[model samples]
Target: MRQDAGNRVPDRLTSLLLGGALLLLPALALAVSPEPKTFRDWMAGCDNRKSCAALSLPPLVADTTAYLRLERPAGPDSAASLILRLSGDWKTPPATVELKLDGTPFPAAGKAMPVTANDNIATLTFQPADTAALIDAARKATKLSIAAPGLLAEISLSGAVAALLWIDEQQSRLNTPSALIRKGSAGAAPAAPALPVITARPASGTLSEKGGKALAAALRKHIKQRDPDLCGDDASPAVADEAWPLDGKRSLVALTCSLGVYNASNAFWIVEGNAVTTAKPVNFPQNDGGATNMLTNGEFEPKTGRISYFAKGRGIGDCGVAGGYAWTGSSFVLTELSMMGECRGIGSDDWITLFRSEVKTAR
Candidate 1:
């Protein structure tokens, strides 16, 4: 049926809008895609540099403590690295482990796999060829088991496919051969982006014991007046407020903000000369792209201008948020930050790296 010019133009405009929306579907999905997304039994996260890592979690068995970390940086030439780490309460650490797929012995995949062992931790790094094969099998297999005489770690591959596919999506390798889940004969992906760098200024000057106490007290009073709602006095005042000299006229002070059973928050400030009125909260860069002043169980090192914070998830400190910063005279920059959202008995040092920077301190 022939239509009028006005009707034809409206129909054409609707068609164009729908076509554009179809083309933008993928980008729209990615725009709101959650970083550190959880896919069933697995968790995947990509850093700012498009360096993706997927962590595998084993079944919740007290005796079994092991997981796989599949990491690949964004680049055509970059290859995937798979590390299987095992460390938990056991009679003795296993010297080696055998691979199994769906309850069957998988010696072919384990052949020539590099093994590193110590008293507490044992790790196996799969070869590049084996890593490719392992990823292929894991995407389809139900379970991949790492077993020894007394140790066994059963990793469920429920969402292995999705997690790997998300990594490929984040790295723009969806249809390329570099993709872990989906592979095609597409051309090379873009090179890995350069890392962010942070230059640290060394803190100087000295603070006597009495001077430190007085500075802390003044800063505490100033904070109470400035942000009274923040750090109401808790009964646990045993942990004394601390102060470190940042420079000749400026000093950094930490007042015990709040205390918990397993964690403590410290309010930091930079005070100039003896003017406590000039004290302000330390503007620390946060991982989520903002500035914060609170640090949990933090301490400062004057020589290196380093300040670190470690908030344990539990008393055992198996999982939590841990990071450090390097002072840049005017502000503190985050050098590294990682988080273990789950307290799955994983070591504190094993948290997933979310943000990292090339830190350069004064020589």
Candidate 2:
């Protein structure tokens, strides 16, 4: 559930509906990496390294909680990992886990998987061989039955096969013996790709509370003058401005731009853009197909010099966008991020990880 951050290609591509036929367009690039795919009740996606995840969609029945995540790194010999979680009034964590495929016990006729408790969550581990067995079991199973302490649910396997197959194709494991669902002697999938590296300058410098308030107000006025449509009378009356030094000469500034009933958007820029330096907007990491420079509910941290934002799509907090960036001295770099596409009933706390990176101070 935690990752450095990734560019999640939109889950579903836009298709134009014709009178009687569906018109398809070329696959476009929304971000640097591949897009996540939706099949039935499953979502599958992979990062730059070919490491991929196939997750079970939430139940259609509102107010029900059941989720399963299958993750595997790219390579010919990779280990499979499974994380099963649920949200409900289940008093205590389950002591054992049991699974059935198509109403029949699998992996073991009647044996139960031991569960470990941690922070009120249950855990189940499986060996690579066991994972292989489960994948093989899923090939013909129509429904996945899960049982545990204070938890009992049946997750649809309708799209499970398609999702896993998609992952195989994405990781170049399709038709290869290494593939989870598809199998062939074609060859092993290429090694997992390395994550992109971002060398950032540690965040530094802080303005006095009064200086910060003053400069923030000034910047807000400046932005309003330059882009009235972005911060006009119709925009939020309240303004916010915060500054953090990226270097001795230039600093990063964030100011309030627009506001919604449930979210407030902030704009970021280089503090002193003028005859000496042109003030330009900084594009932050995003996956929700929104503006990068203007983040909703954005905040700049002085301690880490990192800026993060969370945009709630609704007041109930069922869905929205969330991400953080590190100052690279020259620009903000995406460090950690996650997103939940549909509000449905999925908790806001479980944004899917699209991209992740290993960041080091460039100094």
Candidate 3:
């Protein structure tokens, strides 16, 4: 997939949970705001003094990057404008100047504007029709780049300005309060304060071999309850893996459920979390002793980084299988399990595989 940086919205669920928390608790939310002492403010200050040339102009070079920052004031009828303070040496003063709004070429109407010799600064006033579309386009841009056909040097944008612009646009729609409330009535309940959202870190510490055996034992017990034939006297083609690094802080444990008869396997990794734990499972494709095929499905948990699933086998080689490791801090909890290696004279057949895994903090 072609990665479009601008089009990517950070994972939706993560955004929702984080955004909800911020909306509910503004004070504690991460705020993006512009600084009071900015280039725009400096320009305005200089203009008020009626001495534009007094401001020192920053140098601009050809094929170099440059840009201006802007923020629309909050409110519906706020005046829109694109203000750029140009600074650079002009080799050949072009007869006419052209402005591109949001990467779209704009039609030039006026003659070339003169740049002040002392300050090398020039301001281009955009018309109303141009301002609206420009403002709208700017609000959607995470990063803005500006260029003049033959200008050089680079410009740096302040994050603060970008943040302020975003805030202004976001608050614009809520400029007026609703008038549907009853006369002299108190408003609806106040919004809840936002809460801090934290993701659970993987567990640390060394996993006890004994504990791994015990977890596998517990899983086998659970599996037996569902299908008595699934667990035999010996470890039923299923093996367990664990990660317990020397740090002794976090760990991972997994149970491999393999269907030897059908040539398929599914491995489930149990992870640790602060409140609720999770599991990660991986599936593997099964090739017939040269005859059957296989398919599988699974689920993933973003917050805790876990996946889980079951596999079914059919058509000599048709079966579901998966296997993968869960990163548990210092070491990896690896697993490899599958089904469908043993097959006699072929015939279409079916088999069902079911399994589950859970995450719990180290006790």
Candidate 4:
């Protein structure tokens, strides 16, 4: 009898193993199938340069506000190449522009450098060594002031640019203190408006599977031309029943969709109207922890106008990236995707799948 009982143990174990394998089959299929890449892949294909060309510099306006504009080409790297363009009337360049970073004066001995002044334009190029000092100075200045022999121009820094500069400078101070410096402000550039927040009625549309597939195909073609790594062999399609609300008015189509890198899943809702519209993703930090992606949940106010979304990528420990988006008339526009934290041992290649999508109607 004991021998018989012992034999049953093996049978039980075998059955359990078989059942487990059966359960894993669907997941394995999902992992193996091809999927659609992200809008980033599409944008990367175009001009990923984060220079003045990419920036929609506000229309030239005549205002007393000091203008300090920085330009740099965008790339998938740590530091951004900064081209500081200052415009204003200075009888003569200041003896020495004292730049403060995060409230402390940036170290000049090994960090800060003087910008080249041509005509009334003073240009400074920031290198790796000067990255930190530049970031620090930007952060410390609650009120950015340009002090010269008889020149004093003060302008308040705000919006995404300010946040970006502050973050860049802070990181520099912490990581590479020898890189970066604060150069003097440009004479009267128009103050940047606060970043726009999305607020709209929940959008609903009926997108035919055929139509959705066609749209996806067109977008994929456009995206892959620039980023060959996108979708790759794992491109497939999956749809959702309802649109994922970006805000009260605008919502992304999929609540949980397949993007080659990992499963993009989240719950979304709207925030305050006007000045501030925000949404948070629910399923963040994917199961394996390799899928570190966050997207802002909101859309533009005018339904037919522009749409925007924010995305952050982090996974595999210290490696992370941050950026956002704005929709062009036809497709979405990709903004800067800055590498933050330690981006080592990080795996790329994320994809997306849309199975079912339809526009909702006002009831």
Q: Which has the greatest lDDT?
A: 1
lDDT of 3 by residue, 161-269 (tens): 3333333323332223311111123332222222222222343444566765665555555655655653333465445323232234323334434334433333343
**Backbone clashes, each candidate:** 0, 8, 39, 59
Worst 10 residues of 2 by lDDT: 19-28
The residue-by-residue lDDT of candidate 2 on 1-363, one tens digit each, is 221122122233222221222222121125435556778878777765667787777664522356667887888888678766555546676788788878788667667878676654555666667777777777777777778755786777778888888888888888887777878999788887778777656666655666656665666666667766755444344445566665556666777655556666667777652211355677654334433576667787655667776656455564555666777676676775555555444554445656667777654
Ranking by lDDT: 1, 2, 3, 4
Residue 355, model 2: lDDT of 62
Q: What would you estimate as the lDDT of candidate 4?
A: 0.30
**Model 4 lowest lDDT segment of ten:** 1-10
- Segments in model 4 whose C-alpha atoms lie over 4 Å from true places: 1-66, 70-74, 91-96, 101-104, 108-113, 136-141, 160-363
Looking at candidate 1, the ten consecutive residues that score lowest on lDDT are 19-28
**Which one is best on TM-score?**
1
Assess each prediction's global lDDT (C-alpha) against the native: 0.69, 0.63, 0.31, 0.30
Query: What are the per-residue Cα lDDT tens digits for candidate 1 across 231-320?
Result: 665535425688888888899988876666767677778888878887777876432344567677788988889888776656666555
Q: Relative to the unseen true structure, what is the C-alpha lDDT of residue 352 in candidate 4, on a scale of 0 to 100?
A: 17
Which is the winner by TM-score between candidate 2 and candidate 4? 2
